[model samples]
Target: MPESTPFHDLAAFIALPRVSSLALSPDGTRLVTAVQELSSDRTRFIGALWEVDPSGERPARRLTRSGRGESAPGFLPDGTLLFLSSRPAADPGEGADDKQEAALWSLPAEGGEASQLLVRAGGIDGYATATAAARIALAAGLLPGAADAEQDERLREARRKAKVSAILHESVPVRYWDHDLGPAVPHVFGVPDAGAEPSVMVDCGARRIGGSGHIAVSPDGSLIAYTAALGTLPDEIRDAVVVVDAATGKQLRVLEAPDAEFGAAAFTPDSRHLVCVRERRITWDSPGDVTLWLADATDDQDPGRDLLPAFEQWPGAPVVSPVPGEDGTPVVWFTADEGGHAPVFRLSTGSGDIVRLTTSGAYSDVVASPDGATLYALRSAVDSPPAPVRLDAAASGQEPVTLPSPGQPAALPGSLTEVHTTAEDGTALRAWLVLPQDARPDTPAPLLLWVHGGPQTSWNAWHWRWSPWVAAAAGYAVLLPDPALSTGYGQHMHERGWAHWGGASYQDVLALTDAALRRDDLDGERTAMMGGSYGGYMANWIATHTDRFKAIVTHASLWNMYSFAQVTDFPAYWMRRQGDPLENTERYERESPHLRAANITTPMLVIHGDKDYRVPIGEGLALWNDLARFEVPAKFLYFPDEGHWITKPNNIRLWYATVLGFLAHHVLGEQWQRPDLV
Candidate 1:
């Protein structure tokens, strides 16, 4: 029997299995994905590997399962499945112990128990497999001064024995989004085959890999390419794609530009070219841009060619087709944010031609069939969670077929529709509105304007962190707008709010919210606003600028701009856009929400995580203090062990409960019922 609560219940919703990534076999006969579900203890989510039929004829089957679980599934050329897991080895002599980290494991194609293939001191961060050869490129971290894996292991053991947990940093960025970066530096390793000993391919040394841990192996297994951080200064530190000889560990070429950062390298089938994403460094005068770059693997002096030179939307990392196009030219498949959807696009390298392959949904973890006739990816939209889907690689404006997935949720409590409007400056503004099933003109639902985080991001994809459906389940209409600085729209949309956080972006948000309120199913009088990170920043901005919202919830938000610029985890990145607080105080003085805190009359709920280095806990603490000083009706929801995102399952439940209760008390005129656990 189905659960009584259904997906509308927070408990049942959190327990639903989630499928994340996909890995296709070299021969296109098998497809594998990683599914994360609630553990038996119900404290955390555990990931396990699952096999989905490539033909979509059979039900998805579980391939590997353990308390520690497995993730990052990939297949060797011989059809052997490999993954990373902290699970213990079946044999006692295989060296699986309590101190074991995530190591590489392989399951044979003939079928049997999986065996440990490789182990490292710091564990394997991620790995890449060659499509045409039996070669694997793995990324692992090594302690300072450790010559080899054995020494690294010994050094780790020594630290464990001494009970020391300190990291000495000499670079500008000592910490990342949530974790501190130091003690060990990531390096690339090459394994000729499953049995072969791994050899160093690219030693990252002191320069930490800043971008995604992108590592790709050439089809012939002779070369490896990865993103390597360059420069020592804080502002100068940018990522560059580095190609090296797989066997000798010799640096073949470094693809770098003075004004641009390059990473996410994908080698073509012929191994003569590489496709990567080039990010233009942000400056005070202009916003950053990204495009698909095709770099020559053999020529060191050749600057890469831009495939999407005129393309407005930012393209994701390129996925080189296993087989060339019909014209015999290499074709690259990639997804880009386009008009509220992340669609897969086919790019012909030789002809510089691009075509959209998917008509809807945000796609990720895309992989191509060996024959290049079909593509597979995990697709998700505002009303759905990520699920495996199959698409035609060459077709234009085609809808993908959904494959059987474990992550599919039950029927949503409401429906999703679009809200369109024009900003004050005549710019187009759009939002997604979720209306409850019972909402009607006579009994309209309360409105909740949920702003998205990444000021650089869009509200196009499904986000587990902020599911509008949760609010819809409570008979509330949620509006998710793609304001200025949001992707998927043209570059002009981002530039419209560049450095002027309170100008166009704020107006665009209000414009869409106004359009949403005009609907008959929404109640404008009983409305609230909430956001996290940049969205949190917006909530604060909205509260100070207008008394429209009955209640405002801000999480991990920036209150004092001057303080946040100096204390954020990556100071240089934000400083590039806001400029130095000491010299450039125009945007800071005009836009800092804390400056206008006294204008905030709306009841507010401040939520923040102690480990949130992005916005820092100080922002929330300061905002709470300001609300108290102003004698504004307010509450503070603090998470001591959480980061920018609430990852702990129980804490997530409490988060939703607290926010809902707060909204109910303020917007729905319900009695304040504090969550029991809180």
Candidate 2:
């Protein structure tokens, strides 16, 4: 028999290098990517920038290293590689401490040691550079009432000296994701010269929440476009694109709509237009829709024109061609979820024509060559980890050539196939099945049914957090299904499960699971179900509604729909879909899994991260308590430091170990040996 792969061993899997984020130089001669690997202590993943040969010939080379690591690689106009890091500056000034914030650092094109380019008291959140100019625009936090960096630094110092960690909120949301939204709010700053101090370009004020707003710089270094929440009413909160004069830090125009949310701006190479994402806000009667729009970067009054009025799939961040097409019309490149894959697409701004450039795999961070002949992006799929790939800019349905990368995983211990079925209502369902190599007609592998989160997202891309290959290595067939509300299937898919999370969505999963079990390589008699977030919520629903699965694993899940609506970081978003619990309790009462917890008979493994503001800890705690109240066989795995997802290397190792152990005992009928240091 073939030996098991890295997915079979927790330590080995955790040590595997992961690559993400792609950056192409202005000249298109260099391709850089951020690679994360297990740190020396094996406690965390350290990120470092690596250079990938654009020609796909030379081996990738590491560009920088430090204990604190580096990320968000962007090339300057002069070929300097810029990144964000918290490492101590080479020349520390007064009050510099061992614990430093993430500052801007740059390495010369000729290659040498990196030097700090800019540092702030609150640290730089993210930054973007002008393509044709040396102008740099960054996002940083400014404490309330602070006019400049000096005052901001003084406020931070005073707060540190006083040991005050409090954040006063005057807005609706006080927290976002895993962190508090502030005593400090994000502001866009512009640095026109190499040594000049960054001037505040746009003060986001109390309207902004979470980390930092998305910022984009015009190619000519003349304009800056960013995302910010507008309007004063809490219920009417909508994000709008704010375009500003990069030189004067003056507001030029705000692109917004009464019922739409816009952000993720990409300026055309000519710096005359902007390509951005626009999502219509969800309402009680209808679901939201996402599409691309073209706007005049300088002055367009109305909410621009829809570039994808007829396109079904929602496009991701746009990457305008550095040079116009052969016909002299500007072209935009982007990736959009289509069927079971995310394909790169080419869009013409002049004719409103869109064409698929890639046939398979999910693509991200796509950048066009300076000559507009090639495209570079990071591509991954259900059976593959992310890797750098080069693609033809204008080709249709062409396969991308994988470039030399350090993130290649070992050969899988199994093979991948597809499963398809039709829901009760005639809606077609699809899934990816990872089948162990040893499984045969007489000796079928026990199945593990894995549901995807987002309820609005598809199971098309590679996900390190919930990779099915790991389970496949353990002699199981993992089924990943795209149920109702899954993207890429057009507007009707979302409408199917709108506010009916447990109805059609649940049935779609069951239909796909049933179809997968029909395969000779899968064992229907011994199966388990698992999910996180919305997937977790589905797991809970399945547990209460049926006992088909031998075991179930739910993480960062929702237990009580009414309570979840109130506690989630973005209450309005959920309320918009679920409605006010007090005013309309029918849906909340009918869908809440906690209310039906007594029906659970299958053994369960409950996982939750305390810092997850999206679902919050109460859901997990309540689910655990309900399980205990009903004397259900279950185990609760909690991570205090993790939020939404388990990020720490050690925590992830433990997470996988415990989960696999639980599955082994329940599905395979093996005695469970507790993972070490549990």
- What's the C-alpha lDDT at position 564 in model 1? 96
Off by over 4 Å in 1: 1-5, 92-96, 198-207
Q: In candidate 2, what are the lDDT values of residues 269-294, reduced to their tens digit? A: 78888888888899877788988888
**Model 1, CA-based lDDT:** 0.87
Each model's C-alpha lDDT?
0.87, 0.87
What's model 2's overall lDDT? 0.87
Distance from true location, Cα of 251 in model 2, Å: 0.7
TM-score for candidate 1, please give it.
Answer: 0.97
